[model samples]
Target: MLHADLDSFYASVEQRDNPRLLGRPVLVGGGVVLAASYEAKASGVRTPMNVQQALRLCPHAVVVPPRMHAYSAASKAVFEIFRDTTPEVEGISIDEAFLDVGGLWRIAGSPVEIAQRLRARVRAEVGLPISVGIARTKFLAKVASAVSKPDGLLEVPPEGELQFLHPLPVERLWGVGAVTARALHERGIRRIGELAELGEGPLAAAVGPAAGRHLYALSRAQDPRRVDTGRRRRSIGAQRALGRRVRADDEIEAYAHGLADRLGRRLRAARRVCRTVVLRMRFDDFTRATRSHTLPEPTDRDAVLLHAVRTLLTAALPLIHERGLTLIGLSLTNLDDADSMQLTLPLEARADSTLDSTLDALRDRFGSDAVTRAALLHRGTGLTVPMLPD
Candidate 1:
């Protein structure tokens, strides 16, 4: 398995298209740091950081607005090169994918050679630099790719997987986020080998059963998943990062409604319906809370989704008021194909579906901005980042 990822994707695209941005710090997005060039990153700028703070970190950084269409085009071109290299491709996101070149040893040559050719093709054809990592398992391949970043290629052979993995930091494990890292750190288990020596029972006692089992298996390089091209997204969602400024109740509601509108359109566009509406909130202190409500029936209608979203938001309002909300997001999960939906008895519900399809058609023919909800007429709709098809 080979994991190929573009380096600083959005920022790289900006630098690629313009000569002035090359070899200089580039920051994409105006309000938040969506992507930062290696130079800006070296100056301590990170994604989702406030633009003002990013400037304070890198005073001479070039700030540019996001060009979604251009980025989408570049991603498509790179994926084309990936498919040309191998048919066994599993795209994780717009800028990264896993390609299984194990079968092509007889025809295409070694994995490293194939990865070198893949990188060369992307740079020559799409004008972008990509890093590729080869390993026996997906988890290790992804980790290797992250380690060999900014136009690099590294491979972990089956015989050396353990030798290469165990010495790394425990934070390098797939599920070890900030909280998990802190837990492991406080326990004096900072390395993968240290965590592995703690035994599964003690690890489970430390981080709960599921996560413990997960980390234990990964600490031993035991990932069994394969690269699957037919896999569909289990959930579709969007979020907006609101700066530190406090917002009114109506303002927050407006953002939630806008997110619902975008997500509903995406669900219907993909011919899928969701049974669960999840509300994700981030407080000013950077802590997060999630609330989910499962619908009695699956739906692809905007009105139905908006109602569920508003209900979840209302339930989280007290927490938001107490903690100070900084970000709000909505995710539609428990998904199924649209053909599986049962017929509704209510005439009003059927009419709502009709209106949703009509609006989707209009937006598809014209543009996403062509049709707008009355509530979001004057308010700014949150930024819509590009992603793999739902």
Candidate 2:
């Protein structure tokens, strides 16, 4: 197994396109640090951080807006390389993927040679740096690639797996988040080797049973997970962060309508239909609530999905008022490919479906702004944050 991940994906793209930005601290996205160059990171600037704080850390960092389309194109190009390298490819995110080369020794040489060639090809063809990790399992390969960053390559042979992993900090283990790391610290378990020595009982008492067992196995490099290429996304959804300001009912409803329309378009584009509509909300207090309604029949139609989402939102209105809503999200789940579904639509339902298809066609040809629901005609269409494919 091999894991291939781009080095500072967004920032690297910015540098690749402009000669002046090379070897400088470049920060992408002012509102949030979407990606920071290695130069910026050395000054303690990190991604998903506030731009103000990042500027304070790296005073001379150059900030740029995010280019989602460019990133999407780069991702497609990288995945094409991945597919060319191996038939079994598992995409982890936009900039990272796992390639299983278990049976390619005869044709592609050893895993190490394969990884070196893959890195060279990406740097040459894409004009971007990629780091790769070769290992016996997917989990270890991912960890290895993360450790070997910014145009580096590393491999862990089967015999040296524990030697490579046990010396690392406990935080490097898969499930050790901040809270878990703090707990491990309190127990004087700073390294993976130390955690492994404590046995499962003590680990379970420290964290819950399931998490402890999981951490214990990973600490000893006992991950049994394979490179899965058939993993399908269980849900498709979109969300908007509304911040702390209070919003009127009409405004919130408009956001809901826009999200439903966007989700409907995505569903149709993927040629899939969903039976369950879920409304996810986050309050000002940072608490979250979810409400779901399963439709009688699956649909990718805008009217059906919008109605179900509106119903869920209406049912949750009292809680939203009490908690002071800050974020609204909608997910369509219980998915089935459109080809597999046979819907019996009534005359009125068929008319609505026809209108939906027509509007989708117009948007695809002209642009997303070509058509808008009457409710969102005046207010600008709510922002649709492009999500990395699952």
Please give the lDDT score at residue 129 for candidate 2: 96
List, residue by residue over 1-390, the lDDT tens digit for candidate 2. 999999999999999998899999999985779899999999999878999999999999999888777787888888888899999999878899999998999999999999998998898999899999889888789889989987899999999999998888999888889999999999999999999999999999999999999999998788888888888778998888777999888788898989899989998888788999999999999989899999999898888998898898888888987889889999899998887786474524234357888889999899788988777777766555444553
lDDT of 2 at 174: 82
| lDDT per residue as tens, model 1, 101-131 | 9999999999999999999999999999899
Candidate 1 Cα outliers beyond 4 Å, as residue runs: 244-249, 283-292, 312-324, 344-353
lDDT of 1 at 272: 92
Best by lDDT: 1
Mind sharing the TM-score for model 2? 0.92
CA error at residue 267 for candidate 2, angstroms: 1.4
| Top candidate by TM-score | 2
Per-candidate Cα lDDT values, in order, are 0.92, 0.88
